[model samples]
Target: MVVPAQGLPASVRIHEVGARDGLQNEKAVVPTEIKAEFIHRLAEAGLTTIEATSFVHPKWVPQLADAERLFPLLDDIEGVALPVLVPNERGLDRALALGADRIAVFASATESFAKANLNRTVDESLGMFAPVVARAKEQRVHVRGYLSMCFGDPWEGAVPVHQVVRVAKSLMDLGCDELSLGDTIGVATPAHVRSLLAALNEEGVPTSAIGVHFHDTYGQALANTLAALQHGVTTVDASAGGLGGCPYAKSATGNLATEDLVWMLQGLGIDTGVDLGRLTATSVWLAERLGRPSPSRTVRALSPDSHKE
Candidate 1:
């Protein structure tokens, strides 16, 4: 069996989408400046990729309703890529006007989710985004596509593999720098992950073009990530403090915790380029500000090995 290879990465690129993906579903409205500070701390911790906020209307997602104001505060950082979620032309316009260096467009794998989330068919959603991707390309802004419900869906049971490939191909064909495959309901298993990656590989999809985003709803997030790593997938999306959920999928939980993913990767001798200890501290700080215990099991574990204390 293959492994993630020993030692540290020259530098692993982890795009912390927690502020956007992780916090979007939250009930509380985090202050705009506070969100800026949260992202600042993430960068200070060496996370080069951070998804700051979505350019969607506040009525749709009140948590990230501050995408416009939040954009400028996070832009001056030199090394980090502050990609905002552009829901359509209007959203894309806002991002471009703000000089966003990178942007993310989203589409779902199933029909029900398409209507519920995007109010359009899958094909329609892709068609709508073609121009957006072109515009981003024209302006030299990096584009990333998010394919939601690549695994099981809350409304549609047992997602077919073909559906995932179709959307992936559409996104990549449209010039997206990368495509993030999301297990929206956290219903994926390692077996499912391996099969999907294999299919994508056989279809000539570069692993470099792929990124995995999982939720630990059933506690299998790390196991699924291990499968992705074994397949030579380099990029992974994680959330600090594991803050996030599917806005439409009510049962969904937080993302695969960044602290948890880092803890496991470091333990396996893989090169993630992250300081797990500092990540733990950051998680603690975020949880305090959010007034909740962190969902990261690894963060909790390091909290005074009562035996050691």
Candidate 2:
């Protein structure tokens, strides 16, 4: 590991979304047993917060249609958080039926993205989530709110900082434990990230209550994560093996890979509680299942016989 960097959090809590967000956009429907094993491997690799699946309509996301079947198999796994996405009251109800303790609600910072993704306007979407968040909190289930397109949107060019702050605050006010600001299109630079964090702070949203989910379309994920860390944001979201892209965002690409994030955190001596070798091996294994190589550069570099020491 490299020496620790200054002005950074001593440790970061990586919310791994590979199983959910990563596989959601894949064209092939991964087998339910494979999904179960993937989640198991992730936990074995020290990923405590693994997003298992989304409880959306089968017509909307056919890949995760087995949420009901997949969730039950995770019951034997101990000491790990498997959060599933709940889009509405029904989704929440389904998750609760399966004894889900951690849930995530997703919304967009841009009106176009909201309408296209959720078929509702910004305010309407939040209104829809109000009761869902309330009921989840009522059930004592942990809720994470996702604010997509926080930096830029495909339909709307550059998103204003206030827009993101407004949506984020609304989610927080609705009882979300943490708001994950997503650069859904991967257009955010480090400066943009800093400005957004500064603006959110000015709006009285604590850095502690924020996490960042960046896409690597422009290869700025790590740089932007460093910016977020410097601004005192301790939670960061990453997908294992760079496995995800926003299905709703046409210009978007894969998410920041867990292996890449782990490499950087390990090099900086920042604790993420992930085992890099096992993570790399897992990603390689997953890539084989997906019938392609992982998009993560770190995984490629660290794979056996891929490079010289």
Candidate 3:
């Protein structure tokens, strides 16, 4: 059933965000032990790049407050990149003190999201990230810049491709090793996705350095992903079991499920180094703990209960 696509890359690197982005928005705090176990399970399931947690102030995101405690338990995990999100210099310092070699900085592509998420304007947020990116690069740590609201903003409505390109170029200028373009509100169609990617390329942002993070709000995540793949984007950001959305953006919904993405990649004969069975099992186990079934269609279809009724 595997059909090789003509333009798609031979392999894609899935930037798993289930451990960090997935759990961060939870109303009920997932215990530190469970979070660590979840990460271990994800790693065991063959995800090489897993976002671990955020180092932002506890007051802002109380769910992931145990980042310091949760990060150490994962030290024993080898061969997987454990990247943490750092909001500012203090967050970066805390991550560095704990021996973190990979970190990500979040940026907003619109003024409204910048004010809501970071409490600063777009340019000011970039200024804040400048030092953090510089210091991380100085220490040879890998840095990823996440640009939110790339396709559309809840408050700003449809974002212009030029506006997104401006912010994206600023993030890359900050010495980031990679940039993840976020469709935060899930309002993007395939044509919009292609337009933005082409604009970024025109502005000198190479496809190799860009990753796509899509939300499934309008059910266009997979379609938009295919558009990116056609444009040669190889890194995709997905959450396990379709777990997370932007806590700040009320209209935002769960991210594109990793299980679903894996299924499509498997069908396309693209290698992602993921074992679908093990990953589904992991999501099922976590779902039981959370008292809800996974939102991922692939997970539900592949789970043991899929045969029931």
Better of 1 and 2 by lDDT: 2
lDDT of 1 by residue, 166-227 (tens): 88888899999998999998999998998999888788788888899999999989899888
Local distance difference test, per candidate?
Answer: 0.85, 0.94, 0.96
Give the least accurate 10-residue stretch of model 3, judged by summed lDDT: 300-309
**TM-score for each predicted model, relative to the true structure:** 0.94, 0.98, 0.98
For candidate 2, give the lDDT: 0.94
Candidate 2 residue 15 Cα shift, in angstroms, is: 0.3
lDDT of 2 by residue, 163-222 (tens): 899999899999999999999999999999999999989988999999999999999999
Off by over 4 Å in 3: 304-309
**Model 1 regions more than 4 Å off:** 1-11, 304-309
Q: What is candidate 1's CA lDDT for residue 50?
A: 87
- Predicted structure 1: lDDT: 0.85
